[model samples]
Target chain A: MAIFSLWVINKAGGLVYQRNFADGLAQLTSNEHLVLAGTLHGIHAITSRLSPIGASSGAQVIEGESFKMTIFLTATGTKFVLFTSLHETTTDSVLQRVYEAYADAVMKNPFHTPEMPIRSEGFDSRITALIGTGQS
Target chain B: MTIYSLYIFDRHCTCVYYQDWHRTKRPKPAVEGGILPAVSHAITPQPLPADSNAGSTFTSPRNTLTSTSGVVIAVNEPISPGPGLYQTPPSHQQTQANPPPSTSGLAFDEEAKLVYGVILSLRNMIKRISGRDEQFTNYRTSTYKLHLYETLSGYKFVMLSDPNTDSLRFVLRQIYNGPFLDFVVRNPLVIMDSKERGIDNEYFRANTDRLVKGLSVFP
Candidate 1:
C-alpha cells in the first residue's frame, strides 16, 4: 500500500503541516489546508473529550472511510497525524516510522520549527528513503 | 583602523575598529539597569550620508564599524557526560555568554533586506508546515503564529494563526522586518487578504535561504 500524504495539527486543532506524495488526490488551496487542520483538530478534540477514560487511550479514532488517519503522541507531548489511503488497519506502525524520521530529520535540525512545513534537507532525504524502501 | 590581534597564550583572535562620522554629537540616553550597555553607550543612529543609499553596492555595516571589539575565545568546552538535568543550566549559561550574531543582513542593501525577509518568512513557513513549535531564543514567546505555504505555482500565501481568537491575521512579520517593510506594506504590488491560493514554491525555495543570510545583521 502506498502512503499518500501527511498532516499535523496542534493540540488546539490548528493545522501545522500538510503534504501530499502522490498526484491522485484532489488539490487543496493553502487556506483549505488550514481549514482542514482546524476541522481535524476539532474532530480529534471532540472524540477525545467524548470518549470515556478506558476508550480514549486504546482505540483508533476514525474520521471517515475515504482516507485513514492516525494520531500518535511523542514523549514530549506532540501529536503527529499520518493520512493514508483507505486500505490499511495497521497505520500505527507506519506512523511510528514517520515519527522517527521526523525526530531525526526535522526535530533534530536546528533550523526546523515545530508544527511547520517540512523544509530540512535531511527530512526530504529521509522521507524519500523511507518511502522508497516501502515501495520495494 | 582595523586592528587584529592573535592571542598566542589563549589561541584567540581579537579585532577592533572605530570610525568618526563627525556629525552632531547627541548626548547618550541613560538606560535603567543593565539591559543594553552597548546601545546606551552608542551615538544615535544617523541617517546614511546623502551620497550613499541603503542598498547601494558599498561596504556593509559590519565592514563599516564605528567602534567594535571582538575576541574569539578558544575555550576547551567540556563534552556533556549524558542527557541529564545537571547539564541544562550550564548549557543555557553558555548561550548567554556568546549570543549568536544576527544572520539576517549580510548584504546590507535595500533589495537585500527584501530578499532576506522573504527567506526568513520562507524558513518560518517551512517550520510551520513541518508542525514544529516556534521558540524565540531571544525572549518569551510571541502569542501568535504566522503560517505560510508556497504552492508549485510560485506564489506565497500567509495566514495568521492567533492563539487568542478565530479570526485570521494575514500579515508577514518577517517581510515587515525585511527591506520591503516600508515598500511592500505601502505599495500595491501585493494583496493582504485572500482565502487561500496557490503560490510559487520553486521561486521561494530558490531565494529564501540566500535572502536569510543576506539580510542578517551582526552586532
Candidate 2:
C-alpha cells in the first residue's frame, strides 16, 4: 500500500503534524495545510447532519480519482488523516499502527505537550521505521 | 437496505427538489428552549451500525421508543433502578440552564445550503489534490453512504442509502434523465434556474417518488 501523506489534527482543528511519503500528490504551501485542516474540521461537523440515521460517523473516507482520504477520529476528538493511493485498501490497519506509535512514543514523552505541534524524536523514528520498511 | 433521502441541486447550487423516505431526524427551526443543552448534557450520538434501517432511531434497537424531550440515551446507560415511575430530572435542570434552542435541528434552507457547500468544497478539494478531471462518485460514513451524480448541465443528484448497499449513482442518473428532464427541463412553463423558485412541482415530485419507491433497495 502506498501512503501519499499523513496529517494529525488536534481537537481544536490545528494541524499538529504532517508528513508526505510518496510523491504523486500536488504540493501545497504550509499555510494551505492549516487551511485544509480547518476546512476539514468544519466539513466533518457539517457532514454528520447529512446522515440518514440520527447518530452518524462524520466523513470517514473521501475518495478522489487518484487518492483517497481515510479519517480516524478518537473519542476525545483528535483526528488521524491518511492520504493513500486508490489501490491501497488497508488504511485502517495503517492508521491503527500509527496511533499505536503516537500513543507510546509521543504521548509518553515529557517534552511533548498536549494539543501542541508534536516534535518528538522518538515518535519520528518510530514512524519512519514502522512505515519506511514498506517502501523501496 | 433503506434509501433515506434524495436532494437535487441545480446548476446555480439551489436545492431544486427534495424528498425523504425514512429519515427520523429532519431539519427543523428550533425557536426557544434548552433542547440543545439537554442533548449535550446527557447522551451523545454514537454511530449506528451499517445495517440500521428506517425508523431505527438513535441508540439501541431494544428500547427504540425511549426518547425523552428530544434527547436519546446511549445503549449502555443505566435506566433508573429506583422505581418504574422514577424518571431523572435531567430535562428540568437543562431547560433552566441558559436556554439554547431545545431542538438542535437545522432549518430546511440551512440544511440544503450545508449539503451544497459540502459537495462544492469537496469537489474543489478533489480537483486541487488529484489535478484530475474525474468527479467523486460516492463516499461513506459508518451509518450511511452518499452517492452523487452530476449531469453535464451541472445538476447534482445526491442520494443517501444504507452503508451496506452498493453504489447507487446510477439511480440518481436515471432520476435526472427521466423525471427531472421531463418535468423541469422539457416543460416550457417552468423557468430554469429561477432564484426564488424551486423546480419542484406536482408532476416532478410524484414521478420521482414513484421511481425511488420502486427501487429494489427500498424496504
State the C-alpha RMSD over the true interface residues for candidate 1, after superposing those residues.
23.0
lDDT of 2 by residue, B61-163 (tens): 2122122211233534543322221243544333322233222445454566777888888887777766668687667788888888889988889898888
- Candidate with top lDDT is 2
Model 1 Cα lDDT, one tens digit per residue, B112-175: 2222233243344323433444311110002222233332332233332222222121122343
A9-94 per-residue lDDT for model 1 (tens digits): 54445565666775434566779677656544433322221111112221133322244456675654356766555566657776
Assess every candidate by TM-score. 0.35, 0.76
Error of 1 at B136 (Å): 40
* All DockQ scores: 0.02, 0.34
Q: Which 10-residue window of candidate 2 chain B scores lowest in summed lDDT? A: B34-43
Q: Is model 2 an incorrect, acceptable, medium or high docking prediction?
A: acceptable
- DockQ leader: 2
Q: Per model, state how many residue pairs clash.
A: 30, 1
Please give, for residues A1-136, the per-residue lDDT of candidate 2 as tens digits. Answer: 5888889998878899998888888788878888888777767766765665577778898877678889999887789999888778778888899999999998888888998999988888887886666554
- List per-candidate RMSD values in Å: 21.7, 11.1
